[model samples]
Target: MPSAPSERPLFLDPNLNIIFSVTLLAVLGVSSIAPVFPTVARELGVSPEAVGLLITVFTMPGILLTPFFGILADRFGRKKVLVPALLLFSLAGSSCSLARDFEVLLLLRFLQGVGAASLGSLNATLIGDLFTGRRRTEAMGYNASVLSIGTAVYPSLGGALAALGWYVPFALPIVGLAVAFAVLFRLDSVEVEPGNGLGRYLRDALAGMKNRKVIGLYLVSVMTFIVLYGAYTTFIPLHLSERFGSTAFAIGLIMSVGSLSTAITASGLRYLARHTTSERLITYAFALYGVSFAAIPMLPGHWLVALPVALFGVAQGMNYPVVMSLLAGLAPTEHRAIFMSANGMVLRVGQTLGPLIMAAVFAWGGMARVFHVAAGICIAMFLSLPLLIGRK
Candidate 1:
């Protein structure tokens, strides 16, 4: 149950506010540098394709290291893992200012991703630790909303900053240091039991993910990202550029509108959840995404594109909080970090796969077909909702 506003200690607790602000930087870490890639490639005399390694190096490490950090967060205290991770994330992300050599910069970006492994998992784990029931749903919704807001703000911010200098784009995440300092003083430590060993650590993590309930949620997360990001990242820009003659700024502006819509819808999900079970909301959200994706390729003009993107964003926002809240609630407290970490890993896998899968579809067909393919994938999952999860 939610505490009455007057009964609560603060309107928005300072410590939790810090946590939410730091959460915004998680999206910033990788995304803030994206628009600068071509500039970095030109400056360093590297192929743009090779420059793409920046994203891969940064993202791949998280896939491998997040689980390790999850176990560490569980074995040690939250601050023990979080403070160092936050500092490292700030330093590694900001150090692009000094990356005279492209290879060295890749190393720094990889380390930054390693550092960021803790931010999303641990932050949400802390939310899990601190809140439950309606409050828990609200916290997850707010966190997802912040991510949507960051998505809206950062890419264009990166483009603007990159115009000034490639190095300037990385500087924003340095704000994370302030949040780290706040967390150091404000967040409380968790009481973790001793870990058995490496074998048990692996087993326990696997067990949590392997549980019938968790597996469905994990698959849903992966597929949702694949379909959403696949169409959004790979084909949307190409379609807009080719079909509508939109420039980088115009494209960014268009995409940000959807992100803004998502942030608004996700923050209000608490009220939506009151009327509909998480399971039902997820089902409807997936269906909405499917229809939106399928409709994009069929849209006759540029103005119609905006409507589909907004629909997709709202669906994504609605789906994400439910996914996070369910995972947090279902996961056992002792093993919750590992479970959350697994979901993070699954998310990255979907993101990585999304473009690749769509690119294959794009080659076989064309840009318009990418959305149709993605729609098929989304619809398949939407139809599976009945089998995968039940009414809450």
Candidate 2:
């Protein structure tokens, strides 16, 4: 049985506060920079499609490196891996503010991605290590809410920063240096028993990932990022800029609207999970995704676009925490880091593919066609969920 809500005040724990802080940094990886993409493209003299590569190159490293980091965390300790990663992420991410050339910026972003490779997975791993049962679920919801809060604040903040100078927002990640030290000094180290040998550990971890349910959840995670990165993060800002002549501040506010909605929805996930199954909530989230994407292309004005953006936020809030909670539950205690890291690996695949795939579509057609196609893909994924995850 799980502890009562009254007995456990979720955010009051120092360990969870560290987890929340790390989660916020993890979010800053993408959200803080997304609002600045248009400004970067304009200042750098890149095409809209070319600018999308900012997202692509930044996400590409995580696909291959995340699992490797996970294994290291499993064998060694979380802080050993996490602290250095945070420092690297902070330094590389902050240096982007100084890059005058586009290629140099891409290189800096790629390095930042390397630092970010393990953050998403490690945060979840820490949550699993520190909490159990309903407390874990509650923590996941609160953590998701914190992630949403970063997403909400970063864009508007980044946008506002961009209005001052295109490079100002890039300097924000320098705060990670402080966070890195906090993790190094303050976060409790999670010790893992070095079970058997590396070969056996690999075999055991891979075995845990082979289940059909795990595979299904992984697919859902991949699809979720595809839509998130492809439409919301990559193209939506461009659409607003090109079609509406919206300022960077306006773009940030628009993106922040979706994130604020996500924060609100995720904050209530504990109650929602009590009333509905994860699969059902996820399915409903996909329906909202489809509707949101379809409505985006039809919006009469950028201000009115918040309706669809808010809907998309609800879908995101519904999807991420549920999928993660389920994955955390399925993960074997001994191999939890690798299992979650594997999910992170696939998440990077989705993030990498989202921009490239949507950029291709944008090149082939236009913004409206890109979103229409995304809506179709969301509906298709929704229909396939029964086959993927099955009726429960």
Best of the candidates, lDDT:
2
Q: What is the lDDT of every predicted structure here?
A: 0.76, 0.90
Residues 19-104, candidate 1: write the lDDT tens digits: 78778877887556654555676788885345546665666776778777888877876778888888998888889778889888
Off by over 4 Å in 2: 1-8
TM-score of each: 0.88, 0.97
After TM-score superposition, the amount by which residue 257's alpha carbon in candidate 2 deviates from its true location, in angstroms, is: 0.8
Give the top-scoring candidate (TM-score).
2
Model 2 lDDT per residue over 313-390, tens place? 999999999999999999977888999999999999999999888999998898998899889888998898888877
Error of 2 at 254 (Å): 0.8
Clashing pairs in 1: none
lDDT of 2: 0.90
Q: What are the per-model C-alpha RMSD values against the true structure?
A: 3.1, 1.7
For candidate 2, what's the RMSD? 1.7
